[model samples]
Target chain A: AQSVSQHNHHVILSEAASLELGCNYSYGGTVNLFWYVQYPGQHLQLLLKYFSGDPLVKGIKGFEAEFIKSKFSFNLRKPSVQWSDTAEYFCAVTSGGSNDYKLSFGAGTTVTVRA
Target chain B: NAGVTQTPKFRVLKTGQSMTLLCAQDMNHEYMYWYRQDPGMGLRLIHYSVGEGTTAKGEVPDGYNVSRLKKQNFLLGLESAAPSQTSVYFCASSYSSSGGLAKNIQYFGAGTRLSVL
Candidate 1:
């Protein structure tokens, strides 16, 4: 089973500040990466995903992520964050091929964007 | 369209009590999943189903049982609840992409917050 690791447990930043949340996973085989965001009292929503092609993928709400296979990292980044960006971010991974039913998620990073 | 729906948005149970969590999807997806989200632990897979009548154990399936009698519904049952089982439960559904041709993204439902006391 693959294990995902999120570097920061909590992050605090002011509005318009750049944001980056580090995420790493442990798996040697072909893996699909994703970033999910959970707003306060809301369900988890897809931010972005990287299956193949360009390592960098753009997602909703101006969020982006870069998948570096060499480092087993898929870090979420945003150049300028808004107060609404305050949410819990999770990194998830699933092995490629037919066995993609299970998703391994990281511990999660809570980002608080101050206005 | 209701992609996925979970019943009993908030539930509180006593220890050793039994309860069931219902997850329904109208997307006609082949894959359904049950996960528990804790404060620090993002989300841990409890159980999953591949097709209408097939079920599989995930990373943390202990104390949990799942059944998928119908194609659109998945039920998660806890025979005896424990305090450690208290967490926000989420149900998700996704279409099975074949031959790695497309993305197998899962759609989640508004979580069911469960508290076992």
Candidate 2:
């Protein structure tokens, strides 16, 4: 079965520090990738998505991810982080083809930014 | 619009008790899904509905039942709750764009946190 893996379980960083969360997937066909973020007491929101075209996709809150097909990876990155960025991030994938439309999500990474 | 809304933000149930989670969406989305969120387990789909009156099982459907009697409503029921069923539940909906086309992003509810003893 297809699955997503996020290497980091938890990450702590000072405000203004750069951030990167690793995500890898196991799927042989074309896939649509996404990054979702959940802030404290808020619903999960889409940060960015990579459907086709550009490998580098920019999302809300200055977050971006690069889809590397060969590596089967779509890692989320931000040059600088803010205290408000402290939240949980999830990576998801959906293979192309039928309208099965199911998303496979990674375990998730919790980031804590200290001021 | 209230994209997706789930009722009873928090609930406590004892083993063998039963309850139903109500999910409503005003976006006129054609697809709705129920998922459980647990620590270390991002989100496991429990059940989904493609359209009104149609329901299907998802990744983790055991111990859960679903009904989509109305297009804007999807209900997830726990016939007999267990401690293992304690977790945060989320409801989401999305529009179907057809045949390999990119679908609308899923809109999630704030989530219902359920504790079973």
The A-chain TM-scores of all the candidates are 0.98, 0.97
TM-score per candidate, chains pooled: 0.96, 0.97
Per-model clash counts, in order, read 0, 0
Q: Which CAPRI quality tier does the interface of model 1 achieve?
A: medium
Best by DockQ: 1
Q: Write the per-residue lDDT of candidate 1 for residues A27-102, one digit (tens) a residue.
A: 9889888899999988899999988899999999999999998999999999999999999999999897766657
In terms of docking quality, model 2 is medium
Clashes of 2: 0
- Candidate 2, residue B27: how far the Cα is off, in Å: 0.3
- For candidate 1, chain B by itself scores a TM value of 0.95
Q: What's the lDDT for all of these models?
A: 0.92, 0.92
Q: Model 1 chain B — which ten-residue stretch has the worst lDDT?
A: B95-104
DockQ for all models: 0.66, 0.64
